[model samples]
Target chain A: MEESLDSYVDKGLVKTYLFTAVIWLCIATTVGFLLSVKFWWPAFLSNIPYLAFPRLQMVHVNGVAFAWLFTAFFGVSYYYVPRLTRQKLFWVKGAWLLYFLWNFIVVAAVIEFLLGNNKGLPYAEIPIWINYIVVVAVVIYAINIFGTIFTRQENQLYVSLWYLMAAIVWSALNYIIGNWIPYYWATGNEGAMLNGFYFHNVVGMMVTPLGLAIAYYVLPIGTDRPIYSHKLSLIGFFALAFIYPFTGAHHYIYSPIPVWVQTIAIVTSVLLIIPVWVVITNFFGTMKGKWTKLTESIPVKFVILGSVFYLLTCFQGPMQSLRSMQKIIHFTDWVVGHAHMALYGAFSLFIFAAIYLMWPIISGKEMDKKLGNWHFWLGFVGFSIMAMVLWAAGLIQGILWIAQVPFLNTVWDIQPYWVIRTVAGAMMVLSFFVLLYNMWKTNKEAASMD
Target chain B: MKRSGNVILIAGFGFFLLGFVVVGLIPWLQPKQSTHTIVNLKGKPEPVNEITGAAAKGRLVYIHEGCWVCHSQFVRPVSGEKQYYGPVAQAGTYNYQLPMLMGKRRIGPDLSDEGGKHTNDWQFAHLYDPNSISPGTIMQPYPWLFHGSSAKPTKRAVELVAYLQTLGTDVAEGTGYKSYWQYKAAQVSAVSTVVSNTPQAVREGMKIYNANCQGCHGIKGGGNGPAAASLKPAPWNFTSGKWMSKYGTTDKDIYNRIAQGVPHTSMPEWATTLKPNQIWEVLYYIKTFSQKKTA
Candidate 1:
């Protein structure tokens, strides 16, 4: 069994997935920077079809979510499943094939976006063909991971495995129901309401579950302590699955979507805080005597920081769902800021922790401490500044609109904040490259020692 | 209860399916209904004011350009949107559209009732180069609309213009097409060829033109202002006697076009931008350029 597991742990595939993720991080964050600049200078690089505001924005979002976040999640899943199951992957060859296929779909979909063959949805903008490909990939992950679990060397299932299972099933269903059904099933308000559910599910169901799974697995390991309460972790998992899916309609709060549906969305969104609190308490409680580990371990610092941002994102999400608050911030830069806080500051930080924790074990080499610190501080500070500026911009724009100020004047007023965002985005991009360099150098040192 | 991976997967799928059924499936399966109407080309009643022909093609162009990304088509009851954009758009307002482009952001004003807010001429010019009309507009110049030069619109430009003019055609609030053409015709045929030519009127006209028209139509009425480079049909040259004679450039004609901008041109309706007295004064100033001989 040990020999079989040794053969199954393919560092080459793991390294490839991480490398692809970092490449996307660099490329997509630069696109994000360019987009922020476009807010201030609408015509800059706009002559190119792909460089235009809307298309470029889509590329940045899709690329970051699929190429950067999901790819890292995929790599971590491969590393994680074996450790939890105490067995090799059910099909290593299939995992390798899925990796290439996933990258191809992401690249092809991005090209399609530039060529204007988009499906016209916000995040599910990938064409129908590419959407099908993603469905196939999700199914493969389910079978492979579940197959390993069935033949596990250990009988006990960890809390992280439950989230992993739920994430996989929900992700597949979310993609199909959100992307496919909306095309033919509905139109007008009904379609918008359905699409809204699909939109939030992409983040709430997929990213949130996978991110929490990583935290549940890594937080204990990083701080060298067992979780405080197994029951709390279980409750957090089920609560999230129940509440997160119903909260999508809150996006269309003031729209023509039936008032009841909007109210349900608001209530479910508030209920989401229960899972958030449970999970946060479990993480912080695990650190009761090991708070000093946060200063000692880079992975612990990232995991702890992610928990704080996660708390902020959940709190802010419920507040924004309120009717009075949605009136002001729904369509403004505040939503943009909130999205970044959740996706980048919270989940991306968790993904970085996974990378840091797993890299040494996989490569058998330690990361450069100085470069890792640079990566953490730069990313944390840059994202915080960008989020704050965008939130402030959103509030100002909302108030000005309510006061009946000319729209163009509001656009001009937000120019300075956008400039600040561009600089912050650049720093975030720089941090990603710093991370890539650290990983590469560590790998090189390992190879030389061998 | 002890749960295995398969059991967890099954439970998760079931939970997600419940939300999917409640929030997604039920709403989608329900019948669509709307009260909006329009007369078809065959003069029959249509359920919805269906967009067809050039207008249909224009909708494709709008999506291809991703115009819906920035401009929402609906207006909410809250946010004082009715005051800004015309009416609070019902769900039915967008029923005719297949993948409704009820966009998310309001980077530009809501285009729900944008069909006839400005004349066709202003729409064309705004499409070509937005700054040519609304100074400081952040909209990019669609030089592609003219296939390069603004001398005349291409076939696609004509189709795009047709689409913009039909955004709110179901409501009586759309640019009252029949009356606008009639009013435009009368203004041209019933105008006096000569201006008042009083020095005071001409001087006041110069000031009005300087403040407004000179940005596009140039100082000295030469149609060569700094912004003229980006304008289509390049602002009308008041100095060209031949062109003036062909179009019957008279005080009443100038006043009419000024008060109600020429359809499909860059010239905006000056009625709100300038007072009636200032429009009359600008007419005298335009006449002086025609009265001059090239030294």
Candidate 2:
């Protein structure tokens, strides 16, 4: 009876994580729709100070990247880390405190940004004070995760542990370096270039690694296959860890930086294809005989599709980093398209898959799998349409811009594309509603399971 | 199995730490060279005149406005940009630029050679209201440049205009417009008869024209301007015969453009920025220069 009750308690923890994931995902998607509209119609929320594109863009990015993805990661880690280690969580209270702190930090940062106190870098828009809160939250998480690992009943650590452990440690270091707080405060206004440098690394070290780590864990587990080769996994991880930090300079290629710095960045960006290809080949190899499983399982479908997008986005990222390509694409909608594909198509889908896979184990019963299927298909179609439209629009914009066509020519050229983006964005909004409905249904079924 | 796993984990961590140290220190220890010496990439670089005291003062205002965020003073060797924006900007061009404003991002065009691009009147009008002339320009309006006096030119706007007119003056050295300001003042005084109908009407017209026409037509009525450098199928040189003949100098045509604006050009409708009567006055002012032989 005690063992049975402990199993139920474990399920309750999973429920908490899943609920948080779904909530943040809906919030992020809704904000994403608002941002999409702002691109075509700047006047949509022109009268409202907080709703302007600059402010809304920062909010949308933080919502999707940090709020939704981090919460979902927390949910997955809580369920899988202890289960894989054959141990109870080292500190449930610490985990709960970390969650609250994370949410509070995000809320405060968004409020400060809306009120016009931002660091003014893309993705690193949150203020200095909010960075402190985030660091504290990460520290708490690191202690809890590490403590659980140290106290595990299982003697042999799993592959998931490797990815998860590295993600936490690296992300913590990334936050410190990316913020460059002491250096920035010391240099004052002259630190803008340095700040840009740090900002690039934040995307490199924090977002990319965390997203890939989650994918590494979820893909193998959902496919019911061990990763195809441990050697390949090690190779991918090490190559990524080594190369990603330096590649941030690619964003600054055309700027007034020293030439060698830009050259170093371009080389590393190209070489990054090695790690990406390794991961892609390994995932495809593992899923080789499991094509039918994708059709049957909503979680597998989202994860596999996400992996495919990850491959496309990383490839395009290196191409865009090329000086000639950047000449046409930088400051245009092409970068926007790349950003959406990376953040929404790749990371968001993987987060959704991880939550779906963990929900039943946490709820101690099966959810209405039919609703999950509906959610998956809606998101899959919506994200694909949105990505394709943006890519089309971006290409049109790039060609016209580089051709030395009149400025008005490029603006007129992209009008039809903007209309398509709006339509695609509407479909994505509908997908969010479907996701909300599915999660709510799952919650109701979990209550009934008791 | 557990013992072997422990050994592997310890070894892995050590290898990772060693890799991190090596990668992090490598760049710092062997830093990239600080500078490069390029050969006469564009032939002997154009001769630069000594920076004037006033131009030096104007450079401060440029930096304060964060103008470097969008406007690149330096043009690259790339064919599309070079052909469109004039000759590629050389390193010698920036010899006198303190904390050089050679920016990234071409939201507007490079201003490497903006001297004698337009008349002082055009510059004044543009600085007052960009939509008044250029219409549909992305440049943020400089309302702060003018004193809030009822539509009259302020001293500050004139100084800023003085600064813009000086860009790319090296090419204009031997021409009658050797000094951009002296040429602009002479042009404004010479064309006083065409615009003498009403100072108030012309002032309102100037406001409308600046906001609408100044980006492509220039701050002055001269054809060359900052934004013109970036435009492909470049903006028409307003002082040229081809421009006047192509767009007729009739009152109706000028009024129609100012009131309704040209479709598919950066020119936007001035109906929002100007009153109907004000738009007519601006048309009258534009027609004054339409019949002129020189800028």
Candidate 3:
């Protein structure tokens, strides 16, 4: 604490994960923009087998969900654990091992996707051998995290630690079940059920809780105030743990999976509102008198904006799970819109906040505020237009479909919307480059200061 | 508070297990047998045939291509999908499929009953370049699946097409194709009737013609629609009246040809897509094109 030389929290490790995330964010968003282009012009970059729509789709998805967001979460975890526990990160060498192993899994998964050697399980398309490596990486990560907590100077565990701990356990179980049982042990109906479980759990249990851990930590820190109610976050934490795993089957409402499972998915999906409501209350309540600070502080502004987006996404989630809504929305770009609001709008924005809040600590210099705001506005405007366009297009497609119009007619109707979506996506794709430039300048300034 | 971390881990694992039981285990353990069928519309239980040979290899090609991401296999009963696609899909219908490409998104139409919807040649042509037979479609072309030309399908293409034809053969081939054939089987021969084209018939025929036939056959009944550019053997110009009397091609013969579809051509079986009345009306509308040639 006396010296400003290195860091007790391992700043080098934190920067590795955070910077890797920014690079992947640029690549992933650009890939995603190309995907939107393919909706209107399927031949765009489609002449090559590697650049085909299906190939790039897997790459774009894993790039965003696992590559960008997952590494960012790891950055937050490494940065927070030492601060929370008041102890140095345990087995520092093991952390670096995890860094290499995890990155290898992601890189390998992308190459396999392009090469058409994928396992053909949508998001779980990484070959089985690579999946095994992923399982190993998570286990090492779990041990490293728990070991630090186990040897902490502080006897009392903070609420963020609780969510972090639970998130890790759930993720370990999630990857094992999601990858193993579906492909190896079963197929057909059972395989599908497990795949569905794995699919939603990747977002729900893994990313949601991990991101919420950072939200709980940083909202108070970013605002320079303590959280609103510690007890409220506890209630939200437990509620999320119990309800999230059951909501997977909502992805397959009218599917041949048993009627009871579908009912359970719908009911549990609605029940998720409790935890979501609790988060909204806790977060907005923390921002009470510091609302003016949000005008100047990028981190506070982004976190608060992300919370509002999270509220919209979670409310829409349960409503769409209902049979009446699912009938229209399922298999449509409406779900794509909803997914964007969750992963990109809510969680990615939260990570953007985390990157800004922690960047000075990692790089030893504050990021440029002007560029940060530019990135923020571009992302917000671009993604907002994209989500709205996709939702309207999906609803129109759904209506025409229900009317028994030829399937091709719906495709024809959405051409204009797809073009608009591509434009909006381009703006979003452009925003990531702004962030990347900011990251580079900030690091350069820090290096010259040293 | 230190021990609370262990408790949280235990409790989290427990909740996940409970979810696993409810969402995954119970349904998997149910006593239901994996039968390969559901009853056809004929009130008879039709046994679903197991895909084998080239179709089996084609199934892998389908998976590798990630076709399931866009094309769903199941046809749900809700949303009046019964009329749109043939037969509400049952669980047993997909029991034999390995990963069960009963996909979620309908970026393309549900392929649950794609079998017999188009002839083998149409499948080859469509797969080679989707925009050829289907104008303005965003489906990616599979030129790699073919050997140099649309006509020269590689082994994988044939296998893929073979698998496509096996999609919903257990039930009726398609919603309209079965009904059209059934209705036509009972209708008396129309070869003797020199009846002129009724105005109502022409109007109805024009609507169906614009919807289905105009993609290949031009609006002016010339073989020059937007999709006609890439088609081999090209669409027949209905407005060219010289061929009808020279070949003694009767009106009845043309009507059957329209339903059955021309072989080795991009003209898909309207029987698979259009009802009998629609075909009859569209035929009358096209006949007016030939009358223009005579005029």
The local distance difference test score of each candidate is: 0.78, 0.62, 0.81
lDDT per residue for candidate 2 within B111-161, as digits (tens), equals: 665555555555555555544444554443455556652145556566556
Q: By summed lDDT, which 10 consecutive residues of candidate 1 chain A come out lowest?
A: A1-10
Chain A only TM-scores, each candidate in turn: 0.98, 0.92, 0.98
How do the residues A1-450 of candidate 2 rate in per-residue lDDT, one tens digit apiece? 335434523566666766776677677677778766654564466445455455565677777778877877777778777777777888899988987888798789778756655553445657778888888999999888888888877786766676677677766765765565423441211122334445555555556666666677787778888878888987887787677666655665554444566687788889989998998898888899998888877778888888898899889999988988877666566777788788777877777787677666565566677767766666667677777776677677667656655453355456667777777777776776776676677768777767
Clashes of each: 5, 31, 0
Model 3 Cα shift for residue A427 (angstroms):
0.9
User: Model 2 residue A434 lDDT?
Assistant: 74
Which CAPRI tier for candidate 3? Answer: medium
Q: Which stretches of candidate 3 lie over 4 Å from their true place?
A: A1-6, B172-215, B218-220, B224-235, B242-295
For model 1, residues B62-107, the per-residue Cα lDDT tens digits are 8766777778787788877665554566665666676667777777
Fill in the DockQ of model 1.
Answer: 0.29
Residue ranges of candidate 2 with Cα displaced over 4 Å: A1-14, A181-197, B1-295
- Model 2, first chain, TM-score of 0.92
lDDT, model 1, position A342: 95
